[model samples]
Target: MKPARKLFLGARLRRLRRDLKLKQVDMAGKLGISASYLNHLERNQRPVTATVLLRLAETFDINVRQFAAEGGELAGPDQLSEIFSDALFADLDIGRQDILDLSDHSPGIAEAIGRLYTTLTETARRQSPSDTSDPRSLITPETWVRDHIQAHRNHFPALEEAAETVGGALANRLTMIDTLCHRLRDAFGVNVEIASSTDLGGATQAYDRSRRTLFLNALLRPENRAFGLAYQLSLLEFDAILTRMVQEAAPSDEGVARLLHMSLANYAAGAILMPYGRFLESAERHGYALDPLCGEYNVNVEQVAHRLTTMGRTGAEGVPFFMLRVDPAGNVSKRYAGESFPFSHYGGTCPRWLLHLAFQTPGKTITQLIETPDGERYFTFCRTIERPIRPTLTDDHLLAIGVGCHVRHASRLAYAEGLDLAKGMATPVGPACAICPRLDCAYRATPPAGHQLAIDETRKTISPYPFLAD
Candidate 1:
C-alpha cells in the first residue's frame, strides 16, 4: 500500500484536540495510541496511518473527507500562491519560496496587506467620477438591486399576503388602528403604550428592559404610529420566518446577504401592516389610488408607495414595479424595483422626469409617462410627503419625502389614468455624472469621464459637449 499520506492531518488533529481542551495523554488514550506516537504524529515527526485516521474519525463522529480536506487551514504554498495572484501585488517581484515562507510564518502581515489593498480599491472607486478613464467602478446601483433580489430569490409571499389583508381590514374601521394595536400586543405579549414626549424622554420607541415592554411617544403622527407598531410586531413574530427565507435563498455575496437580511426584516414589518392580498385587492378596488390606501391603512403617501412596490411576493405578484425616492436636491434616499430601472453611475438625475417637477409642487401629486433617451418608457407618479424626523420626540422636524413608480404599472393606480405612456410622452433620462452621455441634455452636470471632451471656446454647443468619435 502507498505510504499513508500525511498531508498535515496530524497537525490538524492535534489542533482540533487542543481546541477541544484535551491533553495529549487524554487524546492518545481515547484514540488507543501511545502518547509518544501521538506526540510524534502531532510534531510532524511521523505520518498518520489509516488505522489512526479511522479512529480519529470514529471518535469525532465526523466524515473522513472533511478531516482530510484542509478544514479552513491553508498551507504555506497555498497562501503564498493566493498572495502572488492578488491584483494589488502584481507589480511585486519576489521569489516563490520566499513568499511561501512569509505566508507560512507571518500570515498576520499577509492579511493586513490584503485588507489595505481592498480598502484602497474601495476608496478609489468611490472618489473617481469619470468612468471612461477609471477602470474600477464602484458597485453599480443596478447590480446592487440585482444582488439584493437574488439574495432573497424574490420569495416573500407571507409579507405580500399580510400587507394585503391588513391594509383592507384597516380600510373601513375608524377604530381599526386601535384594534390592530391591541392585536399586536395580544399576539406578541408586548404592551402598546403611547405616551407623550415627557413620558418617552426623547426616545421614539423605548424598550424598558425591566418591564419588558415598549413605549411609543404620542407626538408621532397617526400614520407613523401604526407603522411603528407593525414594525415592532414583525420583529417579534416574523423574525424566524424571515431568517428561514434568507437561509433558503443561500446568498453567495456576504454584503448582499447582509443587506437582504435587513431588507427582508423591513419587508416583514411592512407586510404585517399592509398584508398583500388585501392591499392588492384594495388597490384594484380603489383604482390604484394612493390617498385612500394611506387613509385606509393609516399610513403616509411614502409608506403606501414603498409598500406598493413590495407586492412581488410569489404567486400573487403585482405588476413588476420600480420605486425611487429622491430629495429636492436630487439625493436618492430609497430605491427598490421589481423591474430593471437603469440608473446613472455618477451625478444628478435626469431633468426631464417629473421627479424634479414634483418638488416644485411639494404637497401635490403628479403622474407622468417618462421615456429615457434609450427609448425605455415607464409610467411614473411623483408626490412629496412630510415625514417627521423625530416622530415621538419634541425635536422632531418635518422633512418632505418624494415617491414615484414605473408607469407601465400605473393603470391599477388611482392617480391620473388614460394617459398614453406608450405614445412616447417621456423625456430622455441619463445618469447624473460622467457615466451618461446625452449630448442634448441641458441639465448635464458634468461631462462623462469615459468620453473624450473637445472644448471649442468659440463654438459652444447647446450642452456642455463631448466629442462622439467614429
Candidate 2:
C-alpha cells in the first residue's frame, strides 16, 4: 500500500477559529484537546490526525474538503504571486517558498499587501494627477463600501429578521404595491405619488420628508416602483436597525456611511419582498431559474440577481454565488459575492468572460464555463437588464448582469441542464490583463506587468505582445 500523506492544516484551522470568533482556549476545549496541543497544530508543529479533522468538521459545520484545501480565496498563493510579479517589486528577491510561507503563516499581511498593490495600480491606471505616492488616497467611498459588504458575504441577519417580520404583516394583501402604499399612508402618514419624469428632474425616486410624500418616477417599471416603495418602507420601519448596521460597518467617511446606509436599506427591501425562506425554497424548487423566480416574486432581473448573493442564512444556505453588473463601457457598477470570484481589484476584468459578451446579445441569457488561471472552474450565466428609467437616460443605458458559482454547484442550476459539466471545455480567463501570466492569449490588451517582452525582428507571433515565460 502507498504511504498515507500527512496533513498539515495549521493555517486553515487558525482561519476557521478566527472566523468563528473563538479564542484558542475555547476552541481547544471544544475539540477536547489542550490549548498547547492546539497551538502546535495551528503553528504546523504537528500534523492533523484524521480523527481530529472529522471532529473539526462536525464541531463547526465546515466542509472537510474545503478546510483541508491549500490556500484560500483572500490570501491564496496565486494572488500573492500576481502581486509580487509586478515590476515595482522586481528588485526584491521573492522566491516561491517565501511566497508560500507568507501566504500560509501570515495571510493577513499578505492580503493587506495585495490590497495596497491593488490601490496603487488602480490609481496609476486612472492617471490621477494628484498624489500617487500614498495608495490610501485612491481608496474611494465605493471601495470602502464594497469591501465592507464583501466582508459579510453580502448577508445581514439583523435586516433579514426585521424583513421577515415586515413581510408577515404585508401578507394576504390585494397587491404588494397597494399594500405598501396603504402601509406608507396608514402606518407613517406618508402618501405615495407617481410623478412624471420631468417633475423628478432625472432622479428615480425622491422623498419629501417635510411634506410626507414619496414621489416615484412614472417611467419606472412596475417591479421597480414596488421596490422603491419597499425601500422607502424599509427606511421608515428599520431606521434604528440600519443606523446600527452602518455604525458597525464603521466607514470613516460620511459619504461611505451614507452609501452603506442605503445599501442596508436595499437589502432590507429585497428581504421584505422575497422573504428569505420562501425565496430559498422557490429557488431550489425551480433550479434557480431567474425568469421564473422574477415572475413569481414580481421583481426584476437585477433585484433577483442581487438577492441570490444574500442567501447565506446559515443552515438554510443556498449555492454560493457571485454577481457582477457592468455597463457597455466595461465599467463595473455593482458587485456582490457569497463566494470569491477573483474580481479585478485594480483594473478591468478579463475580456474573455461572458459578462462582457452579454452586451452583444441583448435580452438573451448566456451561459459559459470559465476556468481562472488558478485552475478553479465556475459556471456563469449572463443577461442584459434594463435599469430604472431617468429623464437623462436613453435606450443606450442597458447593463449586463452576470451571476455564477463554482462548477461543483453547476448541477443545481436550470441553465446548466443538458450540459456535460465534467468534460465541458472551459474558457481560460485571468482576473485582469496586467497581472495575467498567459503569454499565448491573442486578445491580451497589455503585457504582463513584470515580464520581459521577447521582441524579435526575425519572427512574428500569434499573440501581439508575447513575453518570456518566468
Candidate 3:
C-alpha cells in the first residue's frame, strides 16, 4: 500500500489569512469548509489536501505548487524544536506556534540557532563526568578520543594492517598465549606471566620494563590472559605504527592526542585477536552471534561486541552495528558505531531502550526489534558482561553491552529467529525524550519543546502530562 501524501501548511495558511485581514469564517467560506476545519488546517492538525491546496493557491493568487509540490520540504520546525529542547534553552517558554513561525519565515536564523545548539551538545559530551555542569570541563580527553574513533567508525586501517602483519608472523601458532609469549620474548625479549591480582596492583595488565616482564591479572580466564598479552604485544611490537597514527591524527587538543595513543593500541589489540578477514568470516558464519564467536575466537563477550562494530573494512564490510556499553547508572562508558543510529551522544539513552534493562538479566542475551520515532527500524541484541577484580573477589564491573544493525538485515541474525517483523509493537524509541518527537509514548521524561502545555482538570492520561488539543 502507498503511504499517505501529507502536507503541513498551518503556518503559511494562518499567515495568508492574517495578511488578507480576513477572519476564520471568511476564509472558511472562501475555501468551502467549516470554520472549525479551517482552524484545524491553520493549527497543523490536518495535512492540506490537494483539493484544499488548489483552492488556497487560486484564492491567494499564488503558484499552486508553491504550497503543494514540495509540501513539508522545510523541516525547520522539527530541527528548531530539538535546538530549544537543550537545557540551555529550557527556561524559555517557546511554543510550537512560535517554532513554526520561526521556521516558516526566518528559516536561516532558525537553522543557525540549530547549528549552535548542535555544537553546544558536541562540546558538552566531552566534559568530565565529575564536572559536567562546570562548563569549563567541556573539553576533556575522553571526548576527543571518542570523537576520533567515531569519525573513523572505530576502524583504523594502518593499525589493522599492522595487526594483520603481526598475526601473519605467527600463522601456524595454536594458542594465543604461547604464540604471543614467544613473539614477545623472541622479538622484544619481554617475558609474559600471569601474576596474582595484588602483584599487579589490581590492574588488568601491567608492564614492568625494568624486570623485562608483563604481568597480567592471575584471576583472568585463559582467554583474558591471552587478551592481556595481546594488548601488551600491540604496544610493544607495534609501538611505532600506533604512535605514527596517533601523531597523524594530531588533535588540536594535546590531551586528546595523548589519549588516542592508548586508544590506537587497544584498537590494534582487538584487530590482532580477531584479524579482519578471519573474524569477518566467523561473524558471518555464526550470524554475528556474540557467544559463539567469543568461544571460537577465544575472547570475552565485550571484546566480541567491540570487534563486531569495527567490521567497516573497505570492499569487505560486514553488517554495520552500533554498539554501546553502559554502567548500571545508565552512564554510557563506550560507544562505537559502524553506521548512524538515533541514540543521543551527550544525553542518557531513552530509558525505554532494552539495553538498559539488560542489566536486570545479567548474562542473558535479550533480542529486540526497535523502531525509532522517525520510523527507522533496527535489530538489536544486548547482554550483561562482568569483569571481575579477581578470581575469588566480590568486586566486579557489571556492564551491559549492546550491538545492533538496521532491521532490513534482521534475517541474517540468530537473535531474529522468531521476531514478527510485520506485526510487533517494535518498541517506538528515540535519542532521548526531551528532543524526541514521539507524542504518544507514555515513557517520555519531558514534553517536547515546541508544543503548548495544557492542564485539563477533567481528564488524565497514562503519561504524567497530556498535550493539549493538537
* Best model per TM-score: 2
The model with the greater TM-score, 1 or 2, is 2
Rank the candidate models, highest lDDT first. 2, 3, 1
List model 3 lDDT by residue over 244-342, tens digit each.
787767764555666788888778888888888888888889999988898887788988998888887666778878899888888898888777665
For model 3, the superposed segments whose C-alpha errors exceed 4 Å read 1-83, 90-138, 171-174, 388-396, 468-470
**Candidate 1's residue-wise lDDT over 1-470, tens digit each?**
55533454554666679657999999999999999989877765666677887898788664454355421233333333433444445456445557545544444455455444433545566775334232223444334444445223233566555555555455344565576677666776677777777777666667665675778877777777766776676666667766776676565455545666667766766776667777778877887677898877667787877777666543465665556667666777665555445543223356777676766676687766766554567776677767543543463233333334456566666664666656745666654544454666676766544345778888888777655631
lDDT per model, in order? Answer: 0.60, 0.82, 0.74
Report the number of backbone clashes for model 2. Answer: 0
lDDT of 1: 0.60
Kindly list the per-residue Cα lDDT of model 2 for residues 254-281, writing each as its tens digit: 6668988998898999999999898899
Ranking by TM-score: 2, 3, 1
- Every candidate's CA RMSD: 15.7, 3.8, 13.6
Worst 10 residues of 3 by lDDT: 66-75
Off by over 4 Å in 1: 1-155, 161-173, 196-201, 246-262, 345-348, 389-408
TM-score of 2: 0.87
